[model samples]
Target: MSTKQKRFIPADGLAGLKQNFTKDALSGFLVFLLAMPLSLGIAKASGFPMIFGLVTAIVGGVVVSFIMGSRLSIKGPAAGLIVIASGSVIAMGDGEIGWHLALGVVVVASLLQILFGVFKLGKLADFFPSAAIHGMLAAIGIIIMTKQLHLVLGINPSELKGKEPLELLGMLPSSIMHENAHLAEIGLACLLIMILMSFVKHEKIKKIPAPLIVLAVAIPLGFALHIKTDGEIAGFALVKIGSISEAFKNGLINVDFSGITTHTGIFIQYVILYSLIGSLESLLTAKAVDGMDPFKRKTDYDKDLIGVGIGNTICGILGGLPMISEVARSSANIGYGARTRWANFFHGLFLLIAVLVGVQFIEMIPNVALAAMLIFVGFRLAHPKQILHTLYIGREQLIVFLVTILITISTDLLMGVGSGILLELIINLVNGASLKNTFKTNITLVEEGENYTLNVKDDLVFSNLLGFKKKFQAIPQGKYITINVSEANIVDHSSIVTMNGLVEEYKDGGGKVLVLGFENHRQLSKDPTSTRILKLS
Candidate 1:
């Protein structure tokens, strides 16, 4: 999308809405069905009562829909937030009181997210190397798998507690070998159904989200087998989903106002954790969803963050999980013809309706099915293809990726990512990129009647070139774009790659690009346009 047209696409007027409501409502219902199992699964995986996840979706859709800057992006509990939310509870004693304490952390973290938006710091996440981000997330995926795999086998490995994910994973063989055969049958069946359904390439069949199908199969199968809802079979059972009647029994808005004072230490820890991770994830997801919007709209990432902060604050008070712009749901929204934020609102409305009317039926669902769904989610996050994709970028990048993953699994999230950043900086320095070049970007843009020119005076590198992308993306389509790099004495691989990718994209859109200064540079690997132009040469 052209930078000139990046503003939020507002909802259609009444007449326009009348024309599109059917498409929007159908899209919303589909997403609603898809979100139900996910919400329950993510919340269960995140160590919160299942109801909290439902609350997050309700607030995410109803509150964030009105305020978010993206037209079709959905907001709700996500797999990404599982570690932080669960860890927050665990750090505070892992009980009813701990859950209440975590609410305070959400509020503070949300305040910080708003601050980030206000400061227009949405691009800060771009500084992290793509390798590092992927590695850290993959580690998170593995962590999720380890925790949820137990539930999938219908076993509670809670008895074999360990600090690190690997340590806990060590007990997996035992957990599986002696696993509850019956519930494991259900979980494995659900898992296989999900895996196999992905190959059903027909558009209509693909439209049916896999998680819903898991329940369709598992629910009836459970009833048919007369599976006991509560019992320990090899330390596992067809687990109950807890008391649906007790949902919101405490209150619709269950903020523990005194938690800020009572759990100040853990509260502060989570504030930092949630704000950094939540804002990063939300901004990144919004950026991705923007590219997915069939209408070719560009979402305002800063505004979306602000809206998420506001929604998360409300969810915090209401005993809900922290919310973000979820990529999966948002992609489904666009694919299903969501016309506006009304689709998001309707998705939440449907969730509320389902919970209100079908709480009993939903409760009847065995926990193993939800566990299987999360196991699938975990695999997607750390899929082998994704890991290979990173490796294909560069072996150096692979090193960074693996290091980040290893550190994250061994240490904590913050430390793991921090180590990756530091390592990448060291690698850059070793490659002879100057510190000044890494931090400074001096760009000048000139326009001449449907033709535009962007000039760079300093070395262009990842640390500073994000601004360059913002400027470059603003040029209208079908205009001549001359990225006059002639004056820039030095440019790194990242900058060159960015320039090359944009050039190709612009040309594909019937625009023109003239990259002026890279003719003499040394090529980096197989990508001809990716070269290093350093003054030392």
Candidate 2:
């Protein structure tokens, strides 16, 4: 393909398919191994049958891959969905009625996502501030870590399947105070896995996926020979998966449209919540995957949303769990050298094969091993270094991240996300630029012999960056402009990157530009100093 054509063309879809066949197959097997335990764990967390997660992973990977625009994303039951799904399932009974009804609600909700994508609403992701997104995700990481810790150590609270963090937290003190031996041993095992993961920092070792190694060791150890505790009870006794027939007896299910005929308002509310969370998660994940693409390729976000909507609808119809573009699985696929969507297909194929043919053998796998894997995953999410970095970036951002984490752990995802967004908006408004200066501070034009000095005052954050650039951009073609930032307190990384690009573009266009008064700017440190650049930092 010509360069122009190549830019627009999708990756060698057919060629990537043929070339990555083996790689995709291998990736599929690996993902299957990782996903199977997760599927059951997430489903159990959501207060649903363990089999539901397997169904979601299998169908989501196979069915969603084709419709998705993102080459690297893997769709499956998301941890983010557990809170909502669990609630919906409970609000709706036992047997097919409650679960199927929730599935019905999901189908209706997914239609909204389709509508969002059709209208190019994925761009709404841009409206969210980067600080807030980070805060939100960081909060989610914290919540997941705290709640899953109990599971990592084999402590099953007699409460509901998926209780919020606050409720769980309230119970945690007692759980720890009374000291459940199973919980203690499991917790210790999880800690060990996390330590092992941290020790693996080499490039080659890092590529091995730490969670996989933890599971490889933990499962065999747990299953082949059970470990005894001080109480003489085996640690593996608390680990549970029940049976495969639990999933197959009711292989597929559908919601009762008839119930919605009576309580449409509540149904509509739940439906909207489902679609909103699914869309936001998918949008964020797509952007994340794009960042990881070696070629800097961008996925069409709207198209991917549509694909997710379609995928969810099918998953609902087939008694599958709600699906989203899971970052963990997607990153794993990329790490495994997957080059095409065929990798996703193969992943799904493997999931199905495992459940169908290997179910008997798979059942023998101990939950402690899976729990060990998740404990490592949780550690990565709630890394203390990342939290420290957030604090260093901005106290407001740190607060937002902390609040999100607390609320997520203490309450639920919706409340946590809502709290983060609210905090983010407050931070933005408080730090927002002065409207008067933002609007009126523009250079009319460069006059003859004018040594155009653009004096930037105070902090030059992104909110006022466009105005800063506009003044320079409007300089007369034949005149000179010296951009001064000596008085400036700070410069955002985005603005700095923009400044670098502008400098090159303006110079190439035969315009003389001078950047002065910036010596030790942290933003500048990330970029190289070009020959034409005079200012440093």
The candidate maximizing lDDT is 1
Q: Model 1, range 1-537, lDDT digits (tens) per residue?
A: 776566435455454357678988898899998898899888876767787798799888877887888888999999988888888878766767778778878888998999888898887877776667778888888888887787788676466443458866887898889887778888899999988987898999989888789989998877766665444542234433445457677767666656667777767777888999888888778877866776566677788889999999998887888999988899889888898888898899898887777777776677789888888888888889876765555566677788998898887788778887777666666665567767767898999999899988756766777878889988999999888776665565556656775776678677988877666454444544333554344
Name the runs in model 1 displaced over 4 angstroms. 1-16, 160-163, 233-245, 257-265, 444-452, 470-479, 486-512, 527-537
lDDT of 2: 0.65
Inter-residue clash pairs, candidate 1:
none
TM-scores of the models, in the given order?
Answer: 0.90, 0.74
Model 2 agreement with the true structure over 1-537: per-residue lDDT tens digits = 577764542355667777667877787777766677777767765656667688788877878788888887888887767657766776775345677778788888888889999998885654444455555565555555556566555554443244556666566666566544554454466458658766777867766655556556565655444543324435334344445566555554544665487557657767876888778888888878876765456688899999988988887776667888888888888887776777777878888777777766555555555555555555566678877766665566567778877776665566777777666555543553344543233333334475677776654544456666667667766456687766555544335545775665566455877887776343323233210112233
lDDT of 2 at 83: 59
| Cα lDDT, model 2, residue 129 | 42
The TM-score obtained by model 2 is 0.74
- What's the CA error at residue 104 for candidate 2, in Å? 2.8
lDDT of each: 0.78, 0.65
In model 2, how many backbone clashes occur?
5
Worst 10 residues of 2 by lDDT: 524-533
